[model samples]
Target chain A: MSTDLLTEDQREALQELVNIGMGQAGASIAQVLDEFVKLSIPRISSVAAANLSQEIVRLVGDADVSAIRQAFTTEFRGEAIVIYPEQSMAGLHEVMGYDADTKENKGEILLDIGNILVGACVGGIANLLGMLSAFSAPTLIADQTPAYRLLKPEHIQARVALLVEVYFVLEERDFRCHLIILMPETDILALGQALDRFVDGI
Target chain B: MPLSILVADDSSIARKMLIKALPAHWDITVAQAADGNQALAACRQGNVDVMFLDLTMPDLDGYGVLQAHRDEDLNGLVIVVSADIQEQAQVRVRELGAIAFIQKPVDAGKIERVLKEYGIQL
Candidate 1:
């Protein structure tokens, strides 16, 4: 029995797959905004689920966080998360033409934006992986500190999370999001097969 | 006779792109709205043969537009044009009575194809 979670090659391949998925997403967003959308894959890391939130804050920031998340199941099931700072959501709303006075609708607007982004990102992943996955309606989470605090107790025993950090820039605006793929150790093989199918499809 | 189309989206750039992407010789009248509420009001005044709606908008989203007009006995075809291209999103909009789905950035080829599919000739 092998104790290794994911061979380095597998990690690289998975990261490459995620990059491709995000590329499609970026293109779609650029088209919608009628602007050039640039995306970069800054880093990929494997960490314990217990430290996921802390590591996220370190990579991005500890400020108010808004995210769009969805789950996909093929050989295994895992969540795809995209996190952006709270201020970025306001910028996004502005781009979408919401009135300045409409700030009160931030929660729903943020959820919808996240829904579109995460839907595209996760859909790209599912298409690449050759998996038939459905997405649940998106929900918004505000204030990462409290959310992480709530999640801390349940995440303590979990180990090994696959984190992919992406930086997106729309003209003058700079924003970052993390696409974290979480799966149990037992599902690694299934994930590999899904990746294999995904690569072949591309 | 000039055909009229309603273009609804929150992004000014997107609206401009769609206008630029339309065929130069297509004898059509274009009506633009920034959101669903404005779109609904425009539809009430008639002369709308097609609608290009973005799914994510403040005030009212694309789905709301569809719902508001579903029973209005309007003569226009509702086509959902959005950056949200996930299969699920497409399915939802189609279920809401959209006649067609065109992904964002509005490619000329895609627009041509969809127009042809719906029997709208330039």
Candidate 2:
């Protein structure tokens, strides 16, 4: 699975698919928070699995990273990530209504938001693709490391990765964050035919 | 007169939603299964006429449940209610002899589509 493997048509199809997935995810998040959430332009690209973390780091730029990684299974197994700046964790905690005294509350808040955001994102993507995917519980890690290194795929034995990155902005608050999903190269290839079917039908 | 159906999914939210969305005239006797193995077992018992199965669950998952439905030569129409809506899911559901594959967060239109699949006019 080369980086340039997706053709113009496939690229367009995938872009639309990501757009739908993100929009749905945003809607669900909005419902959960009772606020309006906007999704930015989602960028979709591919890389070797070994380069996954590096590619993610490049896309995410330099930020103190707070991430939750969740793995999903089905015919195609991969990881879904909700990545945010360490700077914004407190704001996110506020938005999620977690004003607690215990230091452990922060970790709990991080995992809760991550789980909601990542699960909805993955579930929404699966819904649009007509794919069956089940998610594991989300794990939170607030590390000032590179995005890729912090949330790389381990369970999937694959050669390439398809990464979709999008920004979620909350209208009622100054909270905006990144949501990334990594699909195995083979999974994307399998989805390629599904995309073709959708495109053909349309 | 009514349909004998099995509704199986690990998510209580999902199962409850489907139960609430049932057509008023269905007059249905519903059996519920919280996971894949229970779904498979219920379908194998040969009591239900149709099963609304979820693909992702704790024990068996949807594929295994469908396989069991086939292995026992069971008689029932399967409608897959899943969040995984990829084309492969659709093809696989059809391959496993499902009458329809409906996406999650099921709404009235989706319910109508399933009904249409079952030869209901409206």
Worst 10 residues of 2 chain A by lDDT: A147-156
RMSD of each: 15.2, 16.2
User: Tens-digit lDDT track for model 1 on A1-202?
Assistant: 2334665556655655555466567766666655556555435566677677777777556676766566666556666666666555546656666666354566655566566666666666666566666777766544443324423526534466666676666655654455555566656657766655544433
Docking class of predicted structure 2: incorrect
Least accurate 10 contiguous residues by lDDT in model 1 chain B: B82-91
lDDT of 1 by residue, B13-37 (tens): 4576677788888899998998899
lDDT of each: 0.66, 0.70
Structural RMSD, model 2: 16.2
Q: Candidate 1: where is the Cα deviation over 4 Å?
A: A1-4, A101-104, A143-157, A196-202, B1-122
Top candidate on TM-score is: 2
For every model shown, the clashing-pair count is 1, 8
